[model samples]
Target: MKISIFAGVLLISAALIFLGPDTADATSFDTRHVNMGMKADQCTAVMNEGIRRLNQANTFCKSTNTFLTGDNAYHTGTICRSGERGKVWPQNHNLRISLDIYPLVECNLKNKGAKYPDCDYTGVAYTNRTIIVSCTSDKGGGVPFHIEGNLVKYK
Candidate 1:
């Protein structure tokens, strides 16, 4: 009985040591949320959040914003990562953010292959632009937006 109990305790200790939480898979950061009002406010929120993420991930980053259309229909930007140091760890590649704030007069019920209605054009905008990161290779983030009436909500 004494031998059996000692063996069981050793086995449990070994399992606890081996099955510990993986540190590499636990360094993800959440992007900031911004839901004010108007198109400018929403766009600025996303842009600013992107910049903040880049800075948090690294010390050296080059971000450029460009307006693609009259309204906030589609805007594409890039954050180039270069020359790194310290605890800041970003993916060693250019981070490109392609934003498409739909229902901006271009998306409507009669707009060619329109599926959803005009006024009901609402969903998470930055669902695909997710940021997954660790202290190494796994690191990035995304922002999601929802439009209700004339106000925008950040997810």
Candidate 2:
């Protein structure tokens, strides 16, 4: 009886370990793509386009949809790992990583708004100085994917 109970507990633990929630999802990979070897300005332009689309869909900006929590006005960095979490990708000459600073805004609806979806423009607005992206080889060129966030440094 003791051996059977131990085996059952071990099996349950292994199942939980393999079935835990994953941090990255399909939507996370659905980010804007940037070509490898592109200049900083070009990469920023692509990211800006994604932000513009998100802003347009935001109801606080007078759109018909509401912004979900944790949504930023600009493209912020995402947790990037080569394989499972914490495993780093082997360095290669073709891999390109770029870091740049960009503007980030947070919008909220005013509590005293006369009507719904009234723009408040009272959320945090600051510069994201640590936008890190990685570009890997694709069909014709490298496509940027992984976005890593870093601690904000004030200067």
Candidate 3:
């Protein structure tokens, strides 16, 4: 039971840690999000929580008027698992987050490990808002905005 709880935190923390300010300009784009340890079973829950966190972040961004287009793309079916998985100890809500240009990461305390509860992370995220780049330019429809970035790790 104890180990499962601890692992749960680890999974969620990995994603929440990486939420930095948006750095997308004409030159280069800069985005960030958390990355889970591939070896751990916590990857599942981390992915789930990532989505939740992303939604929360998007809401905050909207309220703040950070992005005109608003947040796009979401973590789908992320199940950041705890080390304790299966019937024994499965996470409730896995950590699944989304990466957006209007960045504002609200790191969870779990990422701080057992030491720093006020800890946070900032990972480099990449996304393309325009779905139709070449096609849009050719058809004179302009580029359609899109949002695609790191997906929550599963299995």
For this target, which candidate reaches the highest lDDT against the unseen true structure? 2
**TM-scores for all predictions:** 0.24, 0.24, 0.18
Q: After superposition, how far is residue 3 of candidate 2 from its true place, in Å?
A: 54
lDDT tens per residue, model 3, 70-119: 24322211111122111111131212122223222222333433222122
Model 2, runs deviating above 4 Å? 1-79, 82-100, 112-115, 131-151
Error (Å) of candidate 3 at residue 150 is 12
TM-score of 3: 0.18
Evaluate residue 15 in candidate 2 and report its C-alpha lDDT on the 0 to 100 scale. Answer: 86
User: In lDDT terms, how accurate is model 2?
Assistant: 0.36
C-alpha lDDT values of all predictions: 0.29, 0.36, 0.26
Could you give candidate 1's per-residue lDDT for residues 89-153 as a string of tens digits?
23432232222232221111212332212112222233223221122222332211211112222
Model 1 whole-model lDDT (C-alpha atoms): 0.29
State each candidate's clash count: 9, 0, 33
